[model samples]
Every structure is written in structure tokens, then in C-alpha cells.
Target: MDYLDNVARNFTKKYPCYLIPNQSEDKIKAFLTDRVKT
Candidate 1:
């Protein structure tokens, strides 16, 4: 759905890799947090 698309878009925009569907939410949260630090 749209939420997933938004997450995918934002994740791809901020990170070097596409966020895999199997990735844990904790990992995604950590990744986003890491981005905010830099």
C-alpha cells in the first residue's frame, strides 16, 4: 500500500540500498535514526 511505498521511497532516498521486505522494523528504525545523526 501507500505506506509501504512511502517507506520505500524515503528509505531509498536516504540510504544506499533498498529496504528489503524481510528486514526487521528495528533495523529500519535504527537505520533512520542513524541517518538523522549525520
Candidate 2:
């Protein structure tokens, strides 16, 4: 969980225009899947 927290922190720092709330499991999975595809 700490790793994920750090990743979120860095992501937010790099992309301040975006917001990542406590989304649903499916949304998180989809987001990760899209990232992996790229």
C-alpha cells in the first residue's frame, strides 16, 4: 500500500491537472490496463 501511495503522490505531482480519488475497482483496473498497453 505504501508503494501505491508513493506512486499516486508522484503521479499527482507530475500531473497536477488530474485528480485520482478512491475510484471503483473496475475503473482502477481499467486505468492500469490502459497504462500497460501504452
Identify the candidate with maximal lDDT.
1
lDDT of 1 by residue, 1-38 (tens): 45554675676667646545546444666665666679
lDDT of each: 0.59, 0.56
Candidate 2 per-residue C-alpha lDDT over 1-34 given as tens digits, one digit per residue, 9 for 90 to 100: 4555556566666765555555433344556557
Residue 35 of model 1: what lDDT?
68
Clashes of each: 0, 0
Question: Model 1 TM-score?
Answer: 0.40
RMSD of 2: 4.5
